[model samples]
Target: MSVWAAVLALIIERVWGYPDRVYRILSHPVVWMGWVIGKGDETFNKPDETSFETGRLVGAVCLGAFLALVLVVTQPVARLFSALPGGWVFEAAVASSFLAQKSLGEAVARVAAALREGPIEAAREAVSHIVGRDTAGLDEAEISRAAIETLAENASDGVVAPLFYLVLFGLPGIAVYKAINTADSMIGHTSDRYRAFGWAAAKLDDVANFIPARLTALLIALAARWIPGAVPGGALRTARRDSIRHASPNAGWPEAALAGALGFGLGGPRAYKGEVLDLPAMGDGRRELDADDIDRALTLYRRLLDVLLGATVACAVVVWVV
Candidate 1:
């Protein structure tokens, strides 16, 4: 049943996405999670008031509280749906709201479109929405690199990771993953205010992402094999060699796979806020990224989604039969 639910959710997300009207009325689960995290930060993350251990304790409590809240609400709802006729459809639609396959692709496509038709500033503005890096001083190549890198990395975060958890523990699994991801995005940083308090969120998110990130890279490599022009640069070898060089343990996997697939080098010395960090590059191919590269990345991402859909269908069939 859960396997079928995942398939239905993916289909809904790929076809219509979450509608703007529905969003206007209900906002999003992630937005609500963000609000909870924001309030927790405002209440518990005071720099002068709390010590590092205290901050860590508070973050743990907050994480626990949020997880409990989600389980409490969603479990009953899942039970309710299970009692009704074809109720998995409603449950699947709810699950689809948490997955961002179409939205991620569209957002990345907008960056590519902006780069192709607008000024460099416009492109920078478009990419900034999806990435955390400083985009103000980026050139065209840098801007394109940032956008493509985000596309690759978020293929894990926004899509694969949630689906991975869904298959393991159903809706509750994906919900908890999203909550942790939201908290990490809100507070997981090395800045003075967040260094202590965000540790738990950051570490927890890393653990949650560990398996799914590698799976995403594997899917990308598979897509490259079948999808023409997807990985002209040798994704498997490049990923094996350079993936560990990234600042993040998980983000590097997909990024390396993508860089290898696109026949380009990504990463290496990007700015966050105003600070430039000297990071290692991923691939040994082209460093001169362009709008066309963004398009290519999107193409690969779409193919990867098809791969995921196929996998979901096969898994669902097995589960139903068995």
Candidate 2:
């Protein structure tokens, strides 16, 4: 069943993330998706060639077709796998590629480690790999905050959202979510070239993530109860009070929760593309964060994954029995 497949996929991802040598050989599922999306951009998204409305219309149609194509391929494959004995395990391995538990955690853990022992530039460089914001001028606190924010937001985007879809619709569901999320990342931007051409991808990705974002906030709040020095109530309270005030519809939920749980202030005035964005601060806690805060965040994230895995197993049992 799909529920059990979700459990196996989580365990597999936690134990062994996509290996580097394998990535060298196969690149990644997202990379392949990115290639197709790039082709779409190149063929039709001509800024000077097409009008704004034309671009929007074309993007919408292309997005619809891309999603349709994903479902067409993945749905049949899922059915074929279900027909074979122990095939769900093979499907689980395929599904594991869609999860980012180890990858995101390892990346954030490296940032924390670099911040603790390495030079300021090392810390900045590590943080830059995860966040899109300008890291050149970041101080210790800003760098630490950026790292934690990325871990928190990606806990939802990279892990929770994909798993959510996997549980609901098996391999096909997860494939569709990843395709949309990848399309959004590749082309969904506010730049002059992307603003109109990527409208559908941007909006659809938001719609897909809406529930999972809040669910991640709730899960973080739950996991915070078990993490030493984390405040579950504060996480819940801040998420409720400040999540909507964030610049993005979904990112604020988990960011505010993590900030409150760790008693650190985050998300206030960051530079992007050399332009300063005076974003609203998430939690009203201590503004001066250090490497220790990043460590606490990593611990919380690990604990959250444990909680998520246990819940997935429980759901699998329920689905099997029913």
In angstroms, the error of model 2 at 87 is: 0.9
Clashing pairs in 2: none
Q: Give the Cα error of residue 284 in candidate 1, in Å.
A: 0.7
For each candidate, how many residue pairs have backbone atoms clashing (under 3 Å)?
0, 0
Strongest candidate by lDDT: 2
Worst 10 residues of 2 by lDDT: 287-296
Q: Where is model 2 more than 4 Å wrong at Cα?
A: none
C-alpha lDDT of residue 101 in model 2: 99
Q: Per-candidate RMSD vs. true structure?
A: 1.3, 1.0
What is the lDDT of every predicted structure here?
Answer: 0.88, 0.92
Name the TM-score of candidate 1. 0.97
Error of 2 at 289 (Å): 1.0
User: Which consecutive 10 residues in model 1 have the weakest lDDT in total?
Assistant: 225-234
